[model samples]
Target chain A: MKEIVKDIRRWQKQDKKIALARVIDLDGSGPRLPGAAMAVTEEGEVAGSVSGGCVEGAVVLEALEVIKNNERHIVSFGYSDEEAFSVGLTCGGTVHLFIEPLDW
Target chain B: MNRKPQKDISIFDRVEELLNEEESFALVTVVKGPPVGEKMIVFPDEKSGVGFEGSLGNSDLDRVVSRDARGELTAGRSGVRNYGESGEAREETVQVFVESFIQPPQLLIVGAVDFTAALVKIGKVLGYRITVCDAREIFATTQRFPLADEVIVEWPNKLIEKIGQTFGPRDAVCILTHDAKFDVPAIVSALATDVGYIGVMGSRKTHEDRINRLYEVGVDDEGMTRLRSPIGLDIGSRTPEETAISIVAEMIALRTGRSSIALSETKGPIHD
Candidate 1:
């Protein structure tokens, strides 16, 4: 979040709707820790990262939905998903992310 | 339910202000249970105790969460914590994510040499707020080390004495000034602080001589243990850039308490 504060502020100044995704928890060998965050602007601009590029595409999709619906969600990704979520960390770890609008 | 557009702007504005000013704080958000999406900013205060800028609906919950939030802030960790309704412990009713915004750890380099330039570059990559200090004004210019967050022309010991209290286990003090007049007092003052890594660059002979001088100056055995004389791992690095990598690698190894061996050579988890 600290690294992307400038981009976030810029997007905010333009009054662009943004979705923030934060890694709230992780299990096993995760690349990033809990505080790792990523923000996506309505214009498809991105700032920061929540994973080591493995789950970012899925996160962006989630962010788009979050922006469209104005709803918050908790999404989990890992190798253990029986539903075959298509997106998973190659590091064999589980990461729980909270996706929401930057709506306080 | 849609949020009022104006509410988010103010919260984000405050967050930007705090982060820009490098003030440490925690943003607590109720991720689950009642009052979901409620947010609060917990500020560390010495006089009136930890201050709260927003509410999590229930005052009791706010009080309890604010206390726990401060603990998380001090530890520089962010995570989700579970609690019962109204902030009761041992019950899983509410889940709040406490995200701590801690200032980056500091790296005080007591020498504005070529190694200092490399160290400043590497330290910036590692997210350390670097300070390059030297008694010689000529060598301590920002032009010499443009990457350094601060370049100060002051005696190493004097600078350490002024800002030593801020040094902690997460921070490092690397004395690249091998000269006895500078390195000795620098080590003596650095030992007095809780700085995690104190790497004094020197050869084996220089380390031996400096150790004797340090002992003469009343640096005890425990203080001697704190010094990483002949600093950096025994990687046989010769170039300044390679030496900088070795030094920073040693610091990470010291903090993680890991043997600085190749991962292929060692067994067990790569990360703790």
Candidate 2:
């Protein structure tokens, strides 16, 4: 979230609706950690990231719903682990993200 | 549960303020309980109950969750925790996300050389608040180290006296000044603090000679044990940029208490 502070504050100043998606848990080896976060504006502007580019698209959609419905959700993206055994596999990792409107 | 929010200070604004000011705090949010999305801010330095702002829709739940948030903050961890709605144990009626926002560790580079510039860049990339210090004003300017959080023109001992109070296990002191007159005083002052990694740049022979001088100045074997005389790991790095990567990698390995060996040599799970 610190990486997207300027964007968050910018959206806030511009009065743009925004949602936050944070990686709350990890089931296996992954590039990002639990505290990794991504912020999305209502119109699809994004800052930061929740994973190594795999689940971010899905998280953006989820964040859009969070902003539209004004509801919080724990959305898990479970990736296939078989291919991850190969060396230099960057995307096959599982992450649980908490998506919520920045209402508070 | 009926408490009012602070005047003109939303929890998000407070969060940004705390982060910018580098204050250690935790943000707690109820993700799977009544009044979901409700949030609270917890400052671990404050007393229980008094430390919290905002509510989790119940007084008892707020009390319990805020207390646990402090524990999570101290650990510098962020995760979801289960709890009963009324704060009872061994129940999962409520799920609270405790997100810790600890201050970044300080990286004190007691040199103003080309390696210092490289280190400042890499240290910032590793999320360290870097400070480059040297008595040479010509070299210690911000123009030379634009990435450094602070560029101080002072002797190592004098600078340490001013900022050493906050140096702790998470902090690191890298003495890139290979000169004996500069590196020796830097090492001594760094030893005075509890800064975790003390990497002094020198060759094996120079390190041996420096050790003799240190022994002469009363740095015992215990103190000598704390020093990583040749600085970074044996990665055979030749350039300043490569040396910076090796140095920060050494810092990470030291902080995690890992052996700094390749994963292929070990048999355990790669993640751990």
* Index of the highest-lDDT prediction: 1
Candidate 2, DockQ to 2 decimals? 0.63
User: Cα RMSD to native, each candidate?
Assistant: 3.3, 3.4
List model 1 lDDT by residue over B46-142, tens digit each: 3564477778888889889988998999888899999888999998789999999988899999988999999899999998999999999999999
Per DockQ, the best of the predicted structures is 2
lDDT of 2 by residue, B34-119 (tens): 76788888887663335778888889998888889989999899888999989988999898888899999999999899999999
Which stretches in model 2 have alpha-carbon errors above 4 Å? A12-15, A79-93, B1-5, B47-50, B262-267
Q: Estimate each model's TM-score.
A: 0.93, 0.90
DockQ for all candidate structures vs. native: 0.63, 0.63
Backbone clashes in model 2, listed as residue pairs: none
| Chain A TM-scores in order | 0.93, 0.86
